[model samples]
Target: MGKGAILGSAALALVSAARSARTVATWRTVRPLPEAPLDKGKVSVVIPVRDEESTIDGCLASLRTQRHSDLEIVVVDDASTDRTVEIVRQHVAEDPRVRLVRTDGPPPGWAGKVHAMYRGVAETSGEWLLFVDSDTESAPDLVGKLVAAAARDDADLITTPGRATVPNSGWWLLLAPTNVLLFDTASPDGSRGKAVGIGHCILVSRAAYDRTGGWRALSGEHADDVAFATAVRDAGGRTRLVDGMDSITSSGLDSFGAVWRSQRKSMVAGGAMVGGPAAGAAALGLGGLLHIAYGVAPVLMSLRGNGFVRLAGLAAWAAQAAAHRTYMVASHQSGATAVLAPVANATFGAQMLDAAWRSVRGGNLWKGRDIR
Candidate 1:
């Protein structure tokens, strides 16, 4: 065969493989579990809070209204100098299920969140342990669904990707798309079984938590959620991911600055965990540049009128965008955001490039810490 034929065959094979993998990862319908038997296993919910006064109330209120009855809510105040503690106190006063604990400071060699979670876990007792972020609001049935998923699947660790609600601002429109795009692409259905889950919401059986040594086992890791998931999988424990749309919504990002700093910090810290600043910078930089190229190349091809090339590019972009929209719609994201997904994807590619450069320069910052 000619070189062109060989190249064409290779391209076809690559596309076929990607499509097959994506299909395998797409969500499939599962038989819903029967209403969790009333008075089912007890659950202890642990949230780590630090200067999150503005968003803590909604998060706490949502927990107060959980459909599940046997729940104990524990909020660990991670040395917040703001009204975070006061807010928790108010919730604790109003709700008997709520408890507040305070930690002095994060110990050396531990991430702030891991440290806070450890503190909260030490003070709670239940058959199940849930670690949720302070900025996340759970649906009344969120806990029930998670518990049901665990019980039905006999899973040791269960996690759901939280829905991101970006503010209606140009800045957010441009930058906050990173999470939407990344999570949507990286977190297809079966992918969760192969990868570590995000920390935004994680639920584990108390028995599994104890067997794995819980938060303490991953205290030194920056990407605690992913590390914990890996640990669980490594130990022959079952891990499952559920569609969390009916279960939770993240407090929309407050500003573009928050988005930028958060992404940069994540890249740096994640990089450090793997191979330090240099390796992290290279990975982010190359990955971002390639993604940007992928987004831009189709537009250029369409303009050039190379019919076959244009068709291929358009099809690829549409496939990716539609897949994202389907996931968002399933997650109950606003129809408007789903429609604007292509724009969101392009913006995210740009922001990732910016984060890559910062990570390389050793200038990533998070929670007042220089991770790089």
Candidate 2:
């Protein structure tokens, strides 16, 4: 390698080490999802569903077990052609707290999930609204604990990272590294300018939601969570973003094509699902190059080099791998994944670039609907 290239790789290796340490230090400050009791008023859980037959049953089963006494579960059906609605209907009959709402479709300029949320709000009254994704299995104390934490923080909205896992090993290799992105974006400050959102589970107060026109205001976007957080923060409402850890888990992607489409749907404009193609592409390109330098170069160099280069590369490689592994372990995936940090980093970076392309190139699709 040229002197400049070697120097650049060394520089990036140091960068990776710093970030890795920062990742560890960052989590030390994050409080886990509380297991506290729910003293809060009536809490409504709204789960938006489409063709989710494969997972809806398990999701509802988990909700049925929530220990919160004064909770109502509303499963909104967004014109699913599958048995998703049938399954939710069974839950409605089985549990008094569980109710089913149906929407014909999103009106002229709204996203499916956003519209379903609006319908859910109209059907029942609750001081708190907990939006749960159809694929997550929550702990028994999800509602109460989350509410307790939100109340303590005086937050208008709170979102937490799920214990995200991939059922397929092949999918794991490409997607696990992206887990680092999920935890980092939500914010160390989750208050105003720094407040980003997580899509898995968000607990929001009905007052703040209504005051900010929450769901209705986010009617046109699939990446509604961040926009929702932004709306709340802009309105002088507080948001507390934290790690949910074991309190929740999400089966993020099952199919190969899903990894591609889902990443693109999320990569654009930080969840607004659209952005300047050039800007998106540029960011992706630069990030990819840096990953190759810090995340992949050391691994390859360590295996084949002179005495000095080999030892230096070995040290650098260890730092980069350790960082990636820390992220994998924190997200509840196996640390064994860090063994392939080089490959995983390269794959994830390339995937992000592909997502940037598809996102800006008008190819983003989620749940059979175009997001961009």
**Cα TM-score per model:** 0.83, 0.85
Instruction: Judging by TM-score against the true structure, name the best candidate.
Output: 2
Q: TM-score for model 1?
A: 0.83
| Candidate 2 lDDT by residue in tens digits, 68-128 | 8888999999999999999998988999999998888899988888899889888778899
- Candidate 1 deviant stretches above 4 angstroms: 1-24, 29-38, 164-193, 252-261, 334-345, 362-364
Go through the candidates in order and give the clash count of each.
1, 0
- Scored by lDDT, the top model is 2
Among residues 3 or more apart in sequence or in different chains, the pairs in candidate 1 whose N, CA or C atoms overlap within 3 Å are 25-189
C-alpha positional error of residue 129 in candidate 2 after TM-score superposition, expressed in Å: 0.8
Residues 1-372 of candidate 1 have per-residue lDDT tens digits of: 356634543453345236433533454542233355334788999999888998899999999998787999999988898999998999999999999999886888778888999999998998889999888898788888888788777788878766666643333345334433344444422235344476778888877777778888888777677677767766667777666754677764445666565655666677666587777777777767755655555455446635466565555545545545555455555434544444555666666677667676653266655665
